[model samples]
Target: MSDLAILKRRHALLGEKAPLFYEEPVHIVRGEGVWLYGPNDEKYLDGYNNVPTVGHCHPHVVDALAKQAGKLNVHTRYLNEEILNYGERLTATMDDSLSRAFFVCTGSEANELAIRIARCATGGMGIIGSDATYHGNTSTVMELATNRKMGGPKRKKSNVRSVPFPQMYRAPKGMSEGALAQAYAAEIQAAIDDFEKRGIKFAGMLVCPIFANEGLPDVPLGYFELMQQIVHGAGGVIIFDEVQSGFGRTGSMWGYENTGIVPDIVTMGKPMGNGHPLAGVVCRPELGDAFHAESTYFNTFGGNPVSCAVGNAVLDVLEQEQLVEQAAEVSAYLRSGLDLLKNDFDLIGDIRNNGMFFAVELVKNRKKKKASKKKPLRIVNMMKEKGVLISSIGADRNILKIRPPLPFTTDHADIVLEKLTECLIEVEG
Candidate 1:
């Protein structure tokens, strides 16, 4: 069948609301490290996928999956060494206090379970999330996905409070970094105080420590530390949603590592199984123990042997290849190239990056910093025509998201930069 025919069939079944990228969506049939192959055997640089972190169809991970499936594929109810070992490996990477793990299939499930544990352990009902954030699709998690509504009127639920993201690029006028931190921190405190005023117990806060969805906004120093104190003082836990920003995406093992505020609960997915459906919530052992005593929970497919094997293989690849260090090294190189592009292009208003995940903001008038998502939209479609893949982020959708796999090298970045230059020129024209 032709590409358009296939796409029409897909839309017939999936509905119009189902999201697909590009004005002319390419029929991607295969993938390798940081590259995708279209139906006609055309190769496109994959610069917008962090899900296949170690790389697409990695040999080691595929082998592990095949071997485990041939031997056994059973739930965690049985004595499974793979699950146990994978859990140990996962928590070993977290803070010492966060030593327990509960497996789930998606980041949504992980986050939902994390909040439940928080409410169970703390006996509180109020939760905090950023104004532009996406936790998951589940009803409870969707309430926290303020980005889904694109900054519209938020849910009237008092249990969930949305805070303005500490975005330095969009910080209020006349505010230095220090004052910005103070102002953002003060907003959080006020939210907590409002929770108290309404007689709502402070359950905890759910935040993307790296703020990946909000175009990976530059974090304000001292803000996390101050918020940690306030939340804990009010007897609440901190839940870090590391679905996109964790797993070495931000040049660190964990997003909270540089923030100086260790999270009480950490929910991870996407890159956890390196393209497989594996994810979970990690928390302090005591918190899990307390929750377990009151309630019993189990997922049939979660933490099974096959998923565990895939997770283990992903860790193995990350460790053996030192992809974390590679990401850091290559990101510096890529950063320099992006900076050069910014120098050459007047449309680039700002560049925010951490590790391989970077956001390039396009503006109509750089002097006024006037954002125009239409420019990025044009650039996105143009880059597609040039065999490069990237997308936009944020409510305005003006920030181009450049997140290739971990194996992406400086050579690949060069192609992206060159093609992006051509796209920008066309947009300028």
Candidate 2:
């Protein structure tokens, strides 16, 4: 058999009954600043992945990981200065109320831990989330992340409800932005009412400041404030899942900072260790106290010394390089480029962005518009063929998710725009 055929057969055997997102996937062998290289050493511009917040294999992060591993890679049981120092640095960037930190290895675990803390702090069973907002893959968070239809089975007794995402692209007609914000906030209030009707108290609301996986739905201004009031009045905590949008990816220290609301608990990851396995949940001291009193939560490798050291180094690099500011500046440039492209291409329906995080929605028809999932899949694959890497997302997988590392530059933006323009033209034709 041919090499390709053998590889395909092996894949089928490994996933005997599993469903895959793509029929054919590229074999990436290495990555660096804003680029991924295939097994054949072909360079692909990375316009989608954000887990490498700073850049793939950043020198500072690599060095820190190596140094810590050589010195001591112990767990939380042993008192370590690296964990303490990293926690202090991370919490310093958060709101004053969020003065405590609990480390985890991935965004999913961080969010799971955050939900546990929220439930304990409020002593409530009901939880709420925005429609199409992805928190994590764990059972509790999966229950809260009900935007996607494929997100597992519904929780029969888990008092989790979903509110409509505050998407300006599909907002109600004739509604002002402020009015739309209020309307979206009302959805949460309605959820609270439903909870009360069911004799269930409100636990908390989980939100993604930019709604990463659902589409880069920028939360309308004042929306966070209104929702905060509603959740707080209903005796529920607020959790911001900044997993994909944190660590300067949104051009700020944190995504919630752009929303101008201070959440009771904020879970962050992906970029915490610049591609290293590290994540954390920072919460209000009161919530942390409640969580501690409720249960002794610990992970074997959550706050290991190596992860802490790498995380600390990531923070240093972010500050010294001013990558957050770079994201802000380059985001404006990239958005403008996308806007110009939208004018040239009718299929490009919406351009939504926050900092370096952005998405371009591909639509089938401008008039009875609907997401063109097939078109995006084709475009993503075509772009990959053209030496650019991007991904498709949204409820229908029609939105092109454009999130690169903070180190992405104007030159990189130009390359992405050029390749995307070509892909759109070919697809449109």
Candidate 3:
């Protein structure tokens, strides 16, 4: 079928919810390593997909899945070494206190369970999330998707309070980093007070350490640590949503690893099974145990043998290839190239990132540092036209999100850099 016909059928079947990227969406037929291919085998560099963390259709991962599915594909009901071993391996990456694992099929399920655990443990009804964060699609989790309610008229969740993320890039005229940190934490403290006053107990804060959708804003130093302190002080747990930044994206095993605060619970997905439908939550043993004892929570396909095998393979590839280190090295190279572009093009406002999780905030005026509101979509569409793939995020939709596969190299970074520059030039001119 033709592309337009497929699109029409898609809209007819999937309705307006069908999201296809690019002005002229490419019919992606295949992917390998860090490149996507069209029906005619036209290559497009992938700089916007982190789901294929180890790279698309990695043979190592594919083999693990195929082997496990053939031998044993049972659910967690029966005795299974694969799921047990995978859980053990996964928890080993976290702190000793947070050594328990609860497997679920998607990030939303993990988050939903995590919040349930938080509320049960603390006997609280209030949740705190960053102003522009997207947690998940489930009803409870979507209540925490504050990104949708920030700039528009929408029904507010009284129990869920939103706090401003510490964005140092567009800080008030002379605000120092320390001041920025204090101000954001203070907002949380005030919210906690308000919750107490209204007789609503504070369960916890759902945080994405990188603050990805808040434009991957350069979070102020010591801000997260301070927020952790306040949340625990208020008798609430800190749940880090690592769905987008986990599994070797941020040059580490977890995005929260470098943030200095040890999260009480870490909700993860997207890259867990490396394109497979797999996700889960890691949390404190006591919290998980308490929730398990009180509630009858069972997912039929949560920790199945096949998913565990795939999960194990993804982790193995991450370690054997040293993708974390690769992410670190290539991220630096990519940043350096972007820094050079920032020098060449005044449209580049700021480059905010650590490791492969990057955001290039475009600006129309260099002096004013205003967001080039409509340019990112146009630039990404043009980049798609030029045989490269990328996307945007944040409230204004002006910040370019450039997270590629973990196996991306310096060579790939150069290509993205060149294409990004050319796209910016074309868009600006």
Candidate 4:
């Protein structure tokens, strides 16, 4: 059967919930480092994906998986040294107060459990999330993911609130950088006030330190600190959804580190196991105590031996390879290159990046007017046809998201730039 037919068959068997990106999809046969090989043996430079936090199929992670799978892969019901060690090492990377780890199989699960813990601990019903922020796909988290169209109605009206995202490029009039930060904080405070008037205290504020999927917009300096103060003052916990920005993706061990604030809870995934199915929530010990006292939570395969081993190996490889430092160094280089591109391209409006996470916002006529999403989508498809892989996002899909793995090098960036330039030229023409 053809690949399309096979995919259709599989989707049918899996039910109609499966989503397809495009009608016709290139069949990726293999991946190594930052390159993906198509069925026709076409080599595509990966420039817009980072789920493989390390390069795709890093040998260290592969070897660890093989070794652990051969030895043991038991569930969490059984005590295992690998689980204990992995948990300790992972939590050790965070603040001392965040000493407890609750493992799960995906970012969605981690966020779902984190919300439960927060609500239980705070004894409050309301949760606040940023506008255009995506947390996860689980039912509970879906409510918090204001970016998804389906989330609006699924969200419980009384229990959820959304504050405007702090996109500096699109800040309100007269909003200076300092004032923008203050206004964003004030928005959160106002949300708390609204909830208080309704007799609904807040459980927590869920945020991404550097908002991903919302155009890779970085929170203004002092934003999180001020938000934390507001949440704390209102007796609400602060939960950092680091599912995309964690594990050194933001030039730090954790994204919250860059914000200079320790969140009450943090949900991490995607890069934690370097593509392996592992995610976790680390919380202040006191919160953990309260959560555990209220309810027993368990995931059958969350911290299984194999998953723990893979998680540990990812950490080992990150440190041994100094990939975090590499992200920091390469990010600077990429940003400089993007800055140059912005200077040259009139269509490029704004460039925002953190560590390896970079975004290029395209504009229509260079007067800072919003660019049509259709143009960026066309550019992305053109780039893919040119043997380069990148993706477009933003509320309008006008921002090109360029988040390659940590192992992506300067040379890789140059290749991506060349291909991107070709696509841009074609689109411009």
Instruction: Show model 4 residue runs off by greater than 4 Å.
Output: 1-17, 154-156
Cα lDDT over the full model 3:
0.88
Worst 10 residues of 4 by lDDT: 148-157
Q: Residue-wise lDDT of candidate 4 within 108-201, one digit each (tens)?
A: 9999999999998999978999878788888777876666574653544458888998767777767677888898999999888888888887
For each candidate, give its TM-score against the true structure: 0.97, 0.96, 0.97, 0.95
- On lDDT, the leading prediction is 1
lDDT values, one for every candidate: 0.89, 0.86, 0.88, 0.85
- Residue-level lDDT tens digits of model 1 in 346-368: 99999989889989999888777
RMSD, every candidate, angstroms: 1.4, 1.9, 1.6, 1.8
Model 2, range 287-370, lDDT digits (tens) per residue?
A: 999999989988999989999999999999899999999999999999999999989998988888989988898898766568
Residue 336, model 2: lDDT of 99
Ordered by TM-score, highest first, the candidates read 1, 3, 2, 4
lDDT of 3 by residue, 258-315 (tens): 8998999999999999989999989998998878878967888888999999999999
At residue 196, candidate 4 shows an lDDT of 81
lDDT at 30 for candidate 2? Answer: 90
